[model samples]
Target: MKIMVLSSYAPTLFLFREDMMNAMLENGHQVIAAAPEPEEEWESKFKKRNIKYVSIKGIERTGANPIKDIKGFFSILKAIKREKPDKIIAYQAKTIAYGCIAAKILNVNEIYALMGGLGSIIRNKNKKSLARNILKAEYKIAFKSCNKVFFQNKDDCNEAVGTGLIKNEKIVMINGSGVNLEKFTKKQIPAKPVFLFIGRILKDKGVIEYIKAAETVKERYPEARIQILGSFDTNPTAIKEEYIYKYVNEGLIEYLGSTNDVRPYLEKCQVFVLPSYHEGTSKSMLEAMATGRPIITTDAPGCREPVINEGNGFLVPVSNVEKLAEKMIWMIEHQDKVEEMGRESLKICREKYDVKKVNDVILKTMDLKKVRKNQNVI
Candidate 1:
């Protein structure tokens, strides 16, 4: 089968979907990846495995320009025509909205849409906005041709059902883009307390709340290190570098700029935190869990899925700086418990969030061939 995986961001090809695509190739499917402004490195990373990369110049990762999006839809349609894929899996907000429509036009078999997160468009409080309404309608249209819509969390699935975006029968749930356990292997918890947040600097990611919580925690335990690793984003609610830098300058939190690999940071941190307002399921949180780091995230939607509330870690209320700080302080005070919780985190990850396990569910749900263990062609 010729499987085409569409994405708005190229890096996600490596970060989020690498295992799934590799599994498809191992099953003897020809893999084609399409993204906006694809990096040259993509070819070197995938071409040898017979996974082709296609550039869809019309797609933009952020903002709403009808003219541009319309062009993007057409480009996707053209790409579908050219690739003539046997199966199509589209992810990210814009890509799913456009790619599904294109797949439908070409009568592609086994069309799948991954809603990694409801994202700002669906989660935004301002539902009356023209852009939001338009996207909602586009989503309804996209659902028509989608054989299945994979959601990372139950909350997102419920939200879609409530909003009539798609019928409940079409919905499927999977762990947040599964973690590569082998790549993100368990590490010993650092003796020194280091709490880390890994994600885009966006208000939706609760970065501001994380910052505020850091301020509160650090004032009490001045020795505790609060670090953030991620890059600036183009989201409307993105935190300005200046604002994050202000805290960095104040020595409250150490801002380690973005990195292609996060294993080093995950190894260094004893606990991972993400107070995101919502998520389809947070990939960063899962990666940390896979690396044996206890989690400290919100009780909201996807953010809450991985937590067991004192099992692997604590789940504070969303945007609650006080509670978030309280958990941070608790982790700092009970370093012994941190190691125990970290072990639980790794156990849970190995059981439920391993890339192979999660991908097997996806492939079985899509009726695609599932690659057995030790058969990864990548």
Candidate 2:
């Protein structure tokens, strides 16, 4: 069987869904990955894994130009017509919408979409209602033929149902893109208390709030270290380079620019922090958990799923710098309990967010399991 996985961002397929691709391959299915133009390195990586990578044009990560979106829709339609895959699986908002529409047009059966997050349309306060309404309408149209819509969190699923984009029966909630435990094995907590935040440096991610909390934490505990690791994003809410540099110059944060691998940074920190306003299920938080690091995140949709207050990590109110500071300070002061919390994080990862388990759920739900079984591939 042929299975095509579509995403707006190319790297996301490798970074977050490689296990799923590999699973399909192991099950004797041909896998094709469709996304925006990929980096040469990523292209080589996918080739090494025997997965074909097809570039789709005009799928911008930040903007909403209708003409460009229409062009992207046609690009996907063209790919579907050429490849004629047996199943279509798409993730991210734009890809899911366009891919599903293309699949439906091509008369493809077994169409699936993974709603990673509702994206900025739902969270950006500055967005016009008209734009939101248009997006909602597009989602309704795109998902009309989806055999399954996988949501990373229950909150996102509920919101989709509430908006009438999809019914409750069509929804399948999975733990965020699961962590590879073998790759992100537990590490010893750093001796000097380090708090790390990883994600695109966007306002909605609460980057500013994290910086403020870091400033407050540093004043009380001069020995504590605060680190920020992520790229400056092109999103409208992205933190400006100047602001990041100012914080770095003031010694408030140790700014490590974008990295291809986060395990090294994860190894050096005792706690992971993502005070994001929302999320689909934060892959970073799950990675931190697999590495046995306690987390500090906001109590919002995607951000709150991986944490159990006072268990694996603490959950502060969204955009509350003061509370975020308090939690960071408390984590530092109560160093003795940090290891215990870290253990709990690893336990949760094992029980709920292992990559194999998540992929199994995905494959079975897509009915690929039955196909593989009939082929005697599993």
Candidate 3:
């Protein structure tokens, strides 16, 4: 069987979906990864794993441009025609919308859409209803023939169903792109207190709230460190470079920029924080849990899924800088409990969020194993 996985970002295919892709290949299935403006490094990475990489043109990850999106739709349709895949799995908004439509037109046997998150348009409170309505209609059309739609959290699934974008029968809620426990092993808690945030520096991700919380916490515990790891995004809600530079210049937090491997940063942090407004499932939070770091995230949607309310870590109210700061201070004061919480985090990750187990569930759900004659049971 041939499988085609589509994503807006090339690195995401290798970063988050590597385990799934590898499982498909080990099962004697061919995998072709498609993305727009693919990085050269990702092409080499895919080649090393024996997965074919193809570039899809005119995909802008941020906005909605009809002309560009139409071109992108045709490009994906052409790719589907060329690959003749037995199954098509697409992640994120644009890719899922366009990929599913293309696969349907090509008469692909199975189409899977992975809703990583509702994009900024749907989440943006400031946006007009017209745009959201239009997007919902597009989703409904794209998912009309979808075999199954995977969601990272129940909130997203419920919202899609509520909006009539997809039927209840088509939804499958899985742990947010499960973390590789082997790769992100538990590490000893660092001596110095450190809080880490990883993701695109977007406003909706609660970057402003994080900064405010950091400021409040730092005034009390000057010795404690607040660090951010991620690159600037093209999203309209992205945090400006100047704003980040101001924080760095003021010595409020350390900006480590972006890196391929976040394990090193995760290892050094005592707590992982993401005060996001919403998420399908936060991959960074899962990785932090796997790395034995206590989590400090918002009580909203996907952000709250991994947390067990003072179990693995504390969950503060969304956009509540005071509560966020309070939790950080509490963690600092009771340093001994950090290790215990981190251990629980690692335990939960091993049991519920292991990549291999998650991938197995996905493969079984898609019935991919039965479709391949030489499938390897990895």
How do the predictions measure up, each by TM-score? Answer: 0.96, 0.95, 0.96
Model 1 quality (TM-score): 0.96
- Higher-lDDT candidate of 1 and 3: 3
The lDDT of each candidate is: 0.87, 0.87, 0.87
Tens-place lDDT digits, model 2, residues 189-234: 9879899999999999999999999989999998888999999888
Instruction: Return model 2's CA RMSD, one decimal.
Output: 2.4
**Model 3 TM-score, 2 decimals:** 0.96
Which residue ranges in model 1 land beyond 4 Å of their true spot?
39-41, 370-378
TM-score of 2: 0.95
Question: What's the lDDT of the predicted structure labeled candidate 2?
Answer: 0.87
lDDT rank order: 2, 3, 1
Report the lDDT tens digits of candidate 1 across residue range 162-218. Answer: 988899999888888888888988888889889999999999999999989988888
